[model samples]
Target: MIGKKKTDATMILSSEDTRLGPSFVEREEVYTPCYCEENVWKLFERLARDEDEWYAVVISNPSRTAVVLEQRAGSAENGGLVIWDYHVIAFRAIGGKADLVLDLDTRLSFPTPASTYFSRTFLPLDLLRQQFGEVFLKVVEAKQYVREFSSDRSHMRLPDGRWQSPPPDYPCILAPDGVGRFEEQMSITSEDVARRREARGWGTVLTLEEFRDRFL
Candidate 1:
């Protein structure tokens, strides 16, 4: 859920460095597969408190049917597909320019253009409704809608059998110093998510290409 933070007059108009945007300098400190909603919301809350232009966003496909493109360090072999579940990020409107998506968990530079973010990730309207509910979708502002679907990280668990409620300092699946492919390490895939949905008697599973054509 998003919480409004009051910002001072001076902080409201302050412009961030466009070169790097508002990304964290120490990238190693950022972790993944933790309490994504809570951590992302906390980061956005801090930014909103400091700058009035910044706002927190919680995006997800509760049906967990959407697929996103994930680029790693290598060439074609390094790239793979990932399913989009309940994820959170921050946003800021750039006058006359594409909006910014601040997703700390992603490898992309923080405050990347919204167009770029959407190109990599696909969130279908049908999936969004399943997660956020119908009434929330009627609203134009995402901030207003997210509050109704706020995630409780207290019950979140990691593959290593750890509770995400009390987030650890470094809750990443792959250590910063480790050398391994993220997809291999995480075993994240659209097929797996689809299987789970099918087992639950959900609708037909859509392929990645189909999802891209229909949603993107």
Candidate 2:
């Protein structure tokens, strides 16, 4: 329950290099346990409504934190770590194959293989703990996050309102009436996240090894 307002740090980290061409084998019930941003907006609206492209990441850390790591929801000699506060993930790339990370609350392999899903799910920013030692990443554009994402789950609530977990039956993902807001498209920083992409031009914010070396 450490959610302050997720991060978007201006999110837009695709320099483009020929993406999109494979993947589409969904049918496990589409998943929805803790709602990783509505299961990555239903895997970015069924693969960008048929091949628009991918990249809707949003791990976090400006103290909002995130721990991940071989997770299925903790335990097992710490093999299944999971300390999240922000962790929406989506990734798909084509042109030569190898980028796939679509994490539906990862137990791994719903699409893993962004170099084995970030070397088995990120956990080596100097061994962690130092305000998460810089993890932030917000790359968007999976159909522009299905037309500028929004969510009124109210950070999952819980301060008398109830529901700190057990949400996501469906409904709640608005924003388009006035413009983005669900905590500025799930923030990472930039003070109060003005929905940058250089002011709505698109997006831009990176790290996590500068976005996995653009395709490791």
Candidate 3:
């Protein structure tokens, strides 16, 4: 589940350097703002499905007000930190070489070094105020996520049936065999990483620190 796993794809060390990762994923071509989950779905479907070398990273809070920093879309408020009810990204772990992160909204590189990304993206717990809310992480195997995750874009709709934000041009992502398991997958949220060592149907729930120690 963690970085030691291997994949059949070339271990090129950097997706950006190669311009195309496994399955020829071009980040800019596939990315859309506010559709991080779907963007990551395509990434894993292309690059990480054959093996365990990649994982989907979900960051959010029980309050639906997770705070993150240095996002390109962030405003001047909170020193340019952005508040996302939830956000998703793809993580690739290459042994010995630095691991990488693929965050569509970050000011950082498309596939940034794991260590740099964390240091620049996350606010320290000590500095975090209650108003900003706290964030937890879910790190799931890309294979598992691609197979189990589905979204109808219901979360983006207004009661009048108009989209709060424009939907992706691509059709909604559906679970394999049409299982429709998005909520079931999101239900595996928790920060007590040690207590939940065994991976659940979704993945392991981890605090930011636990996520770093385990996945970073």
Highest lDDT model number? 3
Lowest lDDT sum, 10 consecutive residues, model 1, at 2-11
**Candidate 2 residue-wise lDDT, 1-216, digit = tens:** 232111111213343522333445352445566667667777667665455447777777566667877766667697777777778888776753436676766666555657778888888877774545566677777777778777777777878999877776667767668443666666677542334234243355666666666546
- The local distance difference test score of model 1 is 0.39
Query: Once model 2 is optimally superposed onto the true structure by TM-score, how far is the C-alpha of residue 134 displaced, in angstroms?
Result: 35
lDDT: which is higher, 1 or 3? 3
Q: Whole-model lDDT for model 2 versus the true structure?
A: 0.64
Alpha carbon deviation, residue 208, candidate 2 (Å)? 25
Q: Please give, for residues 40-129, the per-residue lDDT of candidate 1 as tens digits.
A: 544543343343344443333334333444422113453434444434555555452336666555555554666676566544547635
Residue 177 displacement in candidate 2 (angstroms): 3.3
Q: Deviation in angstroms for 132 in model 1? A: 18
lDDT of 3 at 146: 78
List clash counts for every candidate, in order.
Answer: 0, 11, 0
Q: Which candidate is the best by TM-score?
A: 3
Winner on TM-score between 2 and 3 is: 3
lDDT of each: 0.39, 0.64, 0.68
TM-score of each: 0.46, 0.30, 0.80
Q: Give the 10-residue window scoring lowest on summed lDDT in candidate 2.
A: 3-12
- Candidate 1: which pairs clash? none
Error of 3 at 11 (Å): 16
